[model samples]
Target: MISVGGYYCSGRSNGHHLQGVAMVISNRLQSSVVEFTPVDECIMVMRLKLAFGFMSLIVVYAPTDVCKLDVKEMLHAKVASVLDRCPQRDICVVLGDFNVVSGCDRAGYEMSVGPHGSGADAGSKNRLLFRDFARSQKLRISGSWYQRPNPLRWMWYSDVGNAAKKIDHILVSTRWRILQNCRVYRSAVVPIINWLWLPSGSISKLPSGPMITLGCFPWTG
Candidate 1:
């Protein structure tokens, strides 16, 4: 099982540039690709889950630097709300372009050279919240276990990693043991990336990352 998502951040207009709004993947979550007249910037979250029999894989996505603590809380809450409602007969895989960083607890350094010198203070508290939440829920981060720049994606911006960080992720539940393989997809020319798991068969990361056509994500169980 696999899932993919693209989040549209209501980030300052300076962060993202766009003309009109359209094609909302999850209107129920109040996400939009375009802002309607002085409205809040739209946001999106995508998840992929591979269930041996009945497990669920949740998609993950978040806006960049949401200052209001209450809003941040709601962001996490809404994601949790969706995941909770999903069936738990199988394991879960939550991942995607999370604007914030979550703390990791597996072992040593996961991503070696991010070009951005550790990205420590870039949402340290939010990272802690994720770390604590993962501990409480028994979820494991997939890519980190490798301890290498496992899946390197090119950022549209400069190589400073300033425009990018290991913000995207693929988190799985502990119960799902025998499964562990993740990869990043990037276009030979495009700087953006897409994350894939179970990574077998016809998948390559040499630029031209995982080319996903239908932008819409799959529904998890």
Candidate 2:
């Protein structure tokens, strides 16, 4: 299985680009496509009872603008449920705009600014949960730096400079052998031609081949 993720910052100024992405991706995948949620981000999430092993994948886009209290809570709740459903899953990959800043895997790709507050209702709570959940499941967060587009300013109505941090990620479960960490690369991109503005030469090219798999050979254990 393969997973793709990108941030759709609700800047609301980029509706044209979002529409383009939907069209291109939809046309490429199989007609058996499935939607995993009532939300915009979801995976095909097919189950294959192969002779070798079963395969499952989940694609999630954490609620945008996480400074919003309700959105943050909704993300944590749904994420916990999604992981709970697949424990020993063979090939599980979770990717998208998590909008989370703290919580790095032990291998150390994510550089978390030490959360600066105390209490059950502060920034620390987010860091604590983000780290704890991944560890409890034996899931692996790619410890290597994956490419992410530059982050925009904090969306909160308040100024918390340190709160600004990376939110996109590519996480895989404990099942697959990571043949090469190099497969995960972030596309450092600038939108030169937005199709929404110009039709002929306005389309931006997505960087080719991030998170590559050698082949879709099934696992048997």
Query: Against the true structure, candidate 1 has what lDDT?
Result: 0.41
Give one digit per residue, the lDDT tens place, for model 2 in 79-118: 6676667546445655444545434333332232222211
Estimate the Cα RMSD of every predicted model relative to the unseen true structure: 10.6, 13.3
Model 2 CA deviation exceeding 4 Å by range = 1-54, 64-71, 87-89, 102-123, 143-165, 182-221
Model 1 lDDT at residue 28: 30
lDDT of 1 by residue, 83-119 (tens): 5765666445555545555433333323321222224
Q: Clashing pairs in model 2?
A: 147-186, 193-202
TM-score of 1: 0.52
Worst 10 residues of 1 by lDDT: 212-221
**Best candidate, lDDT-wise?**
1
